[model samples]
Target: MAEVYQRLAEHLDRLPDGFAPSEDGAEIRLLKRLFTPEEAELAVHLTLDREEVGAIAARASLPEEEAKERLEEMAGKGLIFSAETEGGKVLYQAAPFVIGIYEFQVNRLSDGFLQDLNDYWSTVKERKEPKTINQLRTIPINESIDSRLEVLPYENVYALVEAHDRFAVAPCICRSRAKKLGKGCDAPIDTCLVFGDFADYYVRTGKGRHISKEEAKELLVKADEANLVLNPTNSMLVSAICCCCGCCCGILKSLKYASKPSEAVASSFIVEYDEPKCVGCLKCVERCQMEAVTADVGGVRLDKDRCIGCGLCVSTCPTGALNLVRKPDRGEKLPETFFDTWRAIAKQRDAA
Candidate 1:
């Protein structure tokens, strides 16, 4: 059983997000908690691409019916990824640890599981490697951008919402984990949004409820009002958007440790402060998740490097002292779609 889990860990480590081994073997412990020996063995044979039941069964050397049942069970347990086509054909695939397995466990977390994850993440943080691709990218709220500036379709939160037909709202996994540990904020818990096929999967697995496009837009507005940062999957074809808070979100909290949060995140814009129009109300200071705005003797100070261009400060500023501007050197173009994003990450990891 332990050997099977070890093999599964190595398989996951090869993924783009990476399930790195730890000195304490916490990663293996996490896998033990999540997968049975049989499931782990089957998972090792799976690839990133989705496959039909017969194809997967042949690859695993299992009977077609047995493989189908096992795949369905693993998918329900959030141990792997599965999708049903319009013609009612089912497909199964491997999922990475971060954006896939961990996020899928939103509705099924326990105290023991949380502790194991924390232990694993502690080592992961120390051994972090520089990557060219981020799984998620930051985008300012609709009200934060200047009307005159040209915002790409992917950069516009409203446009992204409008592009999707199907939507689902799920509990923010980070906030759920925080609340379970008794250390989260008062922000709304059900702010995570999934779209299209991801939405179908979430709804099928009972992790989230189906919501209409209008409802999704309304939720985005509410999240904005609550001062949550909007981070969507880093692809032109958005699949999900996480409305995150600094107190609970792992990505936002990691920014606190970064010397330059702006450079650490993928964002097209940065906050530009107009010193002359400033007021001492300190609204921006309270709204900033990155701690980029602080009270100063004159008014409030804006730290450009610390900002992630969330636009929370700009949306609520009394005197319009803050505005978002496009970065002069916005790096490489975003991946065309979600699969493309992961493919690029996998290629980069392979080269590294």
Candidate 2:
């Protein structure tokens, strides 16, 4: 039983995000909490690409009916990814640890599970290799962008929302975990948005509530009003958007203390401060999640390197002292779609 979990952990570690082992063996413990011996054995046979039941059964050397039943059970538990084709054929695939299995466990989090997860996270070492791709990218809020600037459709949160037909709203899992530990803030809990197939999965699994496209846009507005940062998947065809808060989001919390927060995220724009137009209300300082703005004797000081271009400060600036400007030579172009983004990350990880 334990050997099966070790194999599963090794398999997961080969994924793009890489499920690294911890010093205290919390990774294996987490796997034990989430997967049974049979389930882990079956999971080791699965790959990233979705496969039909018969094909998966052959790969696992199990009878078709047994494989199907076990696969469905795993999918229901959010341990694997499943999707139905247009012709009503179901497909199953292995899900990564982050942005996949972990996110899918939103509705099923328990205190013991969270403790194991936190233990694993604490001992996980930072990647020594430079990141060539990111899972999420920051975009300025709808109210923050200057109309005169030419914004790409992908960089506009409203346009991304408009492109999607199906939407679902889920409770922010990071905040949920924080609240479970009695350490979170008062930010809205139901701010995470899923789209298209991912949305359908969330709704089907009872992890999230289906919402209209208009409702999703409204939620984005509400998130902005609540001073949450908008971070969509790093692809033009975004599958989800996270309305993150510095107080609750793990990504934001880690970046908050970093010497250069902007370097850690994929963002197209940066905040530009107009010193002459500044009224020293220090409103921007309060709205900034990255600690990018600070109040000085001479007025507000903008630390360009620390800003992730979230536009929270820009949207709420009383004197219009802050505005978003496109970065010169806007880094690498985003992947065309979410799958492409994953492939790119996989290739990068392989090369590394």
- Name the candidate that leads on lDDT: 1
RMSD of each: 1.2, 1.2
TM-score of each: 0.97, 0.97
Q: Which ten residues in a row have the lowest lDDT in candidate 2?
A: 124-133
Query: Which pairs clash in the backbone of model 1?
Result: none
Instruction: List runs of model 1 lying over 4 Å from the truth.
Output: none
* Cα-based lDDT at residue 279, candidate 2: 80
lDDT (C-alpha) at residue 181 in model 2: 91
List per-prediction Cα lDDT, in the order shown.
0.90, 0.88
Clash pairs (backbone) in predicted model 2 = none
Q: After aligning candidate 1 to the native by TM-score, how far in Å is the CA of 162 from where it should be?
A: 1.3
**Residue-level lDDT tens digits of model 1 in 1-352:** 6899999999998887788888789998899899988999899988888899899899889999999999999998898888899999989888888888999999889888999999898875364566879989999988889999998998999898888889999999999999999899999999999998889999998899999999999999999999899999999989899999998998899887899998889888999889899968998988999999999988988889999999999999988899999988755788877767877888888888
lDDT of 2 by residue, 1-352 (tens): 7899999999998776889888878999999999999999898888878899999899889999999999998988899888888899989988888878898899889888998999999998666776769888999877799889888889989899899888999999999999999898888999999998888888888889999988999999999888899999999999999999998898788777777888777898899999989989998888888888999876798899999999999988888889998887755888887767877887888898
- The local distance difference test score of model 2 is 0.88
Q: Model 1 lDDT vs. the true structure?
A: 0.90
